[model samples]
Target: MTKINAFTYQPLTIPSHTESVSKQNQKPNAQKSSFSESLEEEYEKLPLKLSKHARERIDERDIHISQTEWNLIHSKMQEAKKMGINDSLVLTKDAALVVNMPNQTVITAMGLEEANTRIFSNINGTIVINH
Candidate 1:
């Protein structure tokens, strides 16, 4: 009968001297560009994400927002984040959205009519889109 151990451990291997030297010699700009490229790729993957509550509200309230409008909202949200706005109220022709700028998430949404009757709190900025 052969006995087997339940766990196995592997020793950590340190980088060879030449490997460390090559890494130290790499251009800083090249490293920065690669990191920035990866960040851009991640940003592109999720331009916007709607929370479950936001989606529910959108469907329940029958709000219609076009893709172009969403793109514009996303760009504006990025600008708002740069300006240190974490929570924002976005007013559009047909709908209103509360967005978390840093996370690029729509927290909730409502029709323009409903939005007009309600008070929005904890919002640092507002973006009004005519289109």
Candidate 2:
């Protein structure tokens, strides 16, 4: 296993090969490949993720959000985060999304019509996106 320095964020590689019976007491260490490291970096760079409940709500409501619209929402959410918004109600042309800014997660989603009659609590900001 590769250990990372908490302060430096650098990978500490351990010896992959172990010695014979003379060093039997020592624990074996597995080396992490560069590919795996790159994969982890890419995963960390993802902008947002949908919680299970949010995915269920979107599917149940038959909400259709295009990739372009999703990109816009992510960008706007990042801007909102910079402004000290923790939770936000994002209103798009057809959907309403309650997003947790710091975690970059969508907590819930619904159609605009359904959102209009509902009340959102615990939200510090609201983002209105036309697309």
Whole-structure CA lDDT of model 2: 0.83
Compared with the true structure, all predictions reach lDDT values of 0.85, 0.83
Runs of candidate 1 with Cα error greater than 4 angstroms are: 1-46
Where is model 2 more than 4 Å wrong at Cα?
1-46
- C-alpha RMSD of each candidate structure in angstroms: 12.3, 15.4
Question: Each model's number of backbone clashes?
Answer: 0, 0
lDDT (Cα, 0-100) at 73 in candidate 2: 89
Tell me the deviation in Å of residue 70 in model 2. Answer: 0.9
State the displacement of the C-alpha of residue 10, model 2, in Å, after optimal TM-score superposition: 73
| Best prediction by lDDT | 1
- Residue-by-residue lDDT tens digits, candidate 2, 76-100: 9989999999999999999999999
Clashing pairs in 1: none
**lDDT by residue for model 1 (1-131), tens:** 33359666666667678777777778687888898788556445556998879877886898877778888999999888999999999999999999998888999999988888999999999999997
Deviation in angstroms for 63 in model 2?
0.4
